[model samples]
Target: MNHALKERIIAQSKQLGIDKIGFTDASSFEHLKDSLEEQKAAGHTTGFEHPVIEERLYPEKIFDQPQSIISIALAYPTKIKEKPDIVRGERRGSFARASWGVDYHNVLRDRMNKLMAFIKEIAEDEAALTFKPMVDTGELIDVAVAQRAGLGFIGKNGLLITEEFGSYVYLGEIITNIPFEPDTPIENQCGTCTKCIDACPTGALLGDGRMNAQLCLSYQTQTRGMMPEAFRPKIRTVIYGCDICQQVCPFNKGKDAHFHAEMEPDPEVVTPLLKPLLTISNKEFKHKFGYLAGSWRGKKPIQRNAIIALGNARQKSALPDLLKVIEEDPRPDIRATAVWSVGEIVGSKGNPELEAFFNTLLTTTEAPEIIDEINKVIKKLH
Candidate 1:
């Protein structure tokens, strides 16, 4: 491919909502297959088979006769005001800022498709060179490719960080048969900065860039099924994703760090009052949060998160909602969370209603797991 055409593609990518774009020779990622195997051994990459990812690691699989990989970074604005008090209980609902707007995966997919169309138009005469665009969906290790393509360096938080946008950008890539000149990779800038590691409530980030996914709060909250007992209190108020490490990064300092247009939380769900969130009907949950990223886990996890948040907040006002979920929720895990939240709410106050609920649970001849939890809570209360 001509250098001029490559430059034009980069410029067009910026116009298509990508903040940064860089190209790399398709052959540069030869070592990715080995690295992925190492990650698998370390338990960093789960639910992904090596063979599937190996195919994508070799760029030819994405684009036969491929010569270049165009990596693009879309900066998710992080311009919200800090409400430390809200972390305590002064706020209503809470969600990570990145998830406040429309689903980023969807946003990036739409833009990538447009860029591919432009590429096809410009390269129509070149034996119809093929192209494949991918967001976070593919088997590709997007951050590693972006780093090799010189978009940004990986920070201590295990996030790709750009000097201008800190680590608030999402990455996507397009592999094409058209070869383009590659850019030099940027230097690692995280010197002596331990903020992300220090701020992690669950110690997910070790000194090395490697992260323990099992201990990660973000992964914990989004995961379906039962959460481990030890990490429950550490979850804080997060319903979807965790941003404690990002929030404390020195690179993200100052009011200017906030991206005004995209950082603000949705008013309906922003710092949602825990009392109301626990009682949200399934219909209301779908209508309010369906478009947001957090809704992917469905009403159960969010509801379970709400209960946990209420427990952490010690909000007595959330008792009724907790009671309702405890009695009526179809999911056993959700009922279990409600039981825990009610216990927290009634913590020395010991509401008669809650005591009565526990009494009824004790009489029940079914769901031994729930009965055991109820008994545990009652024991704790006494």
Candidate 2:
């Protein structure tokens, strides 16, 4: 084992502001296959995963001659230093803490790239050393890799819970040929605590360090199509990602790390006025939210969720915007959600103008989905 080099890497990691670093052998994650297959067979997976199962299970498949995996974690701030000013009757939606910073993908990749460069600089034969760095978007399951690397234990919420930083840490890894000694894995500490499972609005967490991703609110919000009606009410105010499970975890209580300046949230961006988001231009969304990890699915999902948030809040003041969306939004899904929101706010209080508007919309709209939504809203208004 490269004990001296490993020690140097650990020291370098601290200097690079990596909160925790650990090493593990690059053996195939064979134990995870049955669980993964079970999830896939049960339709529990979000379609966003890397397509091939083999690539996810074997580090050697992706990186040549892999002997070790160097996993790193960087803690992000759980609290925003400044909260956005609240405006009366102006409803806003939130993004989860994971989405609070500049895109964690960019930040982790930058750190890994720097670490790789440093390794090359200090290595006995730089040309012989091979390294493959990956962040969240990578094929390897980050939590599994982090746990094996001894950075943390996988909590019932399906998050890596570090002793010091809790689950508020972002994870990344590099596959290398170096035979570094492995770190000891942390044992699960959840110990009959079901706070996260009991707190889940959708029951996505399966209470065994696994989750039904299809039922997870985080996945539901990112989906571009119409969100299932069952999960709509569960969303509450979050427009992008759900943090309920993380929030309720005992390990996460009052643990906030403001180590990385880039990870500090701009409150206004993370929690923005819902109405503006409903009609925000593509260019404007990119300009405002492009740097955040949550924007990966684009503005349509965010806008759709914003419409849902308006309905969830029962913000009667947003009736005009919701009505405008129903009347003129180009996207059928947005129009459909807006139609639902209108019903949620007005709720059986017959509005002649709204009834007339929907009646007209039912006649004029071409989309079957929007027409169905309009009919439902019309029924509620009566």
Candidate 3:
């Protein structure tokens, strides 16, 4: 009788603009627990994930008498509609597809709320029932639940790949006391393909879905501190997040779903001019980018990455802006990055005016960090 409720949910989810939905028994994730432990021991977690191992593996800890978990996947767009040109002298940085749309957290939560309300309405006359909905930031391992529910298989690149939607989906789930028939786990589809692994600039993707989060460019981009020296060039033009692995995935090929209007990208915000980000006020930054998922770490990381991107571009046109940031930016890290960009843009330049200014700051700067950064860039310039 409770199994019939699953049919109603499928209908409700479709009505709510949810791309895909599946159900799994609310049992402990035994296999995932072991893998998570291994990841923790090896320091592979991205720190953005839930820190508690037990809570992440056990559904019962979240909801009393939990009997089922409903895993939902919402497909997002891959290709932009009428993307703006990124011409020379006006180079812009890229935000990963995941950050292109309005924050998926809100979109997924709204859909989950509607589904929860519908479930409550239908189960009102039955035994006491409860549910807990969780998105990307939630404690439960979303991909594991989705895989168990047969929504998709976990690919080597550490993303869930559904047959219909490929790997371009935002996942969320509702753990409930109401029992639902469990779905079969999807068969592993990645056969002898190493594109995502070979294509990863940092080699973050270990074989068979394991990953080293510390070396991941996507993970590094969200960090506020200066990026690792070796990875700066690898960071390329991504100011916020990276999509290299996903871009190379075969399953993600020809998979662009414009399912919801809310998921559409404002190309201007997603691919903003790198130089402008160096000076955007906090209020303006929030107003322009706060709606996107990439802005969660605030402007520091974005600004830092923008500096790295400018260096990678080696844009002589950006040299003035980079020098201005080095001279005036309050953040030491930002200024340090600007120093790096300046060196990349104009190596060993004989420009008299800039040379005089550089020598003046090197002799006059009080902060040791800034002085050291200026000297390091000076070495690179020579």
Candidate 4:
């Protein structure tokens, strides 16, 4: 493509709400292959490991007719007013700022569609070619694509960090048959900054920008069914995704943190009081979190997360809610979490309810794991 035409297309993308845009020749991601292999070998793939990723990593394989990749970045605002000093010491319910509003996958997809329409207009005027758009939903390594397209450098926290937006942005791409001039990739800017690594509660981020997904609090909270014992204490107050790494990044300092009005956090979701959450009816749960990305994991994981957060906070006010969940929740995982939370809150005073609930559960349930967990909590309470 002509340099002038390429520049115009990029400029149009920026006008469509994309913060940064650039071009790259569609090619195998050889630069990231070794690191991906290392992640797999180190068992960081966890639930995300799939054969499709291996094949798609080879860009030649992904786009048989493709000539170039157009990468775009959409900045998600993170500007929330700092909490007042009086509330700073309270137990904080954390959600990664990216997920604070409507789902980014939906938001980015809508913008990508607009960009694709713009591309189609240009293509129609110039060459008769087609373009395919892919957001986080596809198999593409979006971060690698963004880096190759000169948008930003990948930070040690395993996030794409732009000089202007830091790590607070969402990425998407368009693979087109029309070849375009490529841009130079930026150099890594994370020099001597181990803040993200040191700040991580679960130590999921390695020094080399690779993440141990199995140990990641974000992954664990969204995981269905039972969680391993080792990760429980590490979860802290994070009920959804963890933001410790991004929060500590020096690049985010002094940047605009206000979110798009559509992305504002629901007051019910921000630093949620645990007592109300545990006893929330299914209808109420859906009403409160229906539009949230966290809701995709459903009530069990979220309720379990609330229990854990309550346990960590040692909030005595949550006792009634925990008791109700322990006695009535049909999901064994949620019940198990409630039992644990009850033990954490009432401690020595937990004898009466623990005995009553344990007796009721023993007579009614047959799942070995659930029964065992309840019994364990009962023993601890005694």
Candidate No. with top TM-score: 2
Give the per-residue lDDT of model 2 (tens digit) for 1-382: 8898889989999898899999999999989999988999999999898888889999988999999999999999988889899988798899999999899999999889989888888878888999899987898999999999999999999899999999999999999998899999888999999999999998888989989999999999999989988999999989999889989888999999999989989989999999899889999999999999999999999999999999999998898888888878888988898988888888898789878888888788789888888888877776
Candidate 4 structure quality by residue, lDDT tens digits, 1-382: 6687787777887677677888898887876777778777778876554457565586666666888898988777665554423443345566666677778777777888887777667665645666777876577888889998999999998788998888888898888888899999987899998999999888888898888988888889888777776777677777888777888999988666453555666654655655566667789888877777777777777778878888877877667777777677777877777677666666665577468868787898876766877777777767
Tens digits of lDDT, candidate 1, 1-382: 5798887787887777667888888884566567566766887653523347656577676566877788887777565455434544344657776687777778777777888887777865756677778866675668877888998888877788777777787789888878788889887788998989998998888666667777888888877766777787888777778888878988877413333244355655655666667667889988988778778778877877877888877887667677777778777887887787777667765556667778887786276656767887887777
Ranking by lDDT: 2, 3, 4, 1
Clashing pairs in 2: none
Quantify all predictions' global Cα lDDT against the true fold. Answer: 0.74, 0.91, 0.87, 0.76
The TM-score that candidate 2 achieves is: 0.98
lDDT (10s digit) by residue, model 3, range 221-290 = 9987777778898988898778888888888889999989999999888989888898999999999999
Which candidate do you rate higher for TM-score, 3 or 4? 3
Q: Could you tell which candidate, 2 or 3, scores higher by lDDT?
A: 2
| lDDT of model 1, residue 34 | 72
What is the lDDT for 175 in model 4?
Answer: 86
Q: What number of clashing residue pairs does each candidate have, in the order they appear?
A: 10, 0, 0, 3
Give all TM-scores, in the order shown: 0.89, 0.98, 0.96, 0.89
Which candidate has the highest lDDT of all? 2
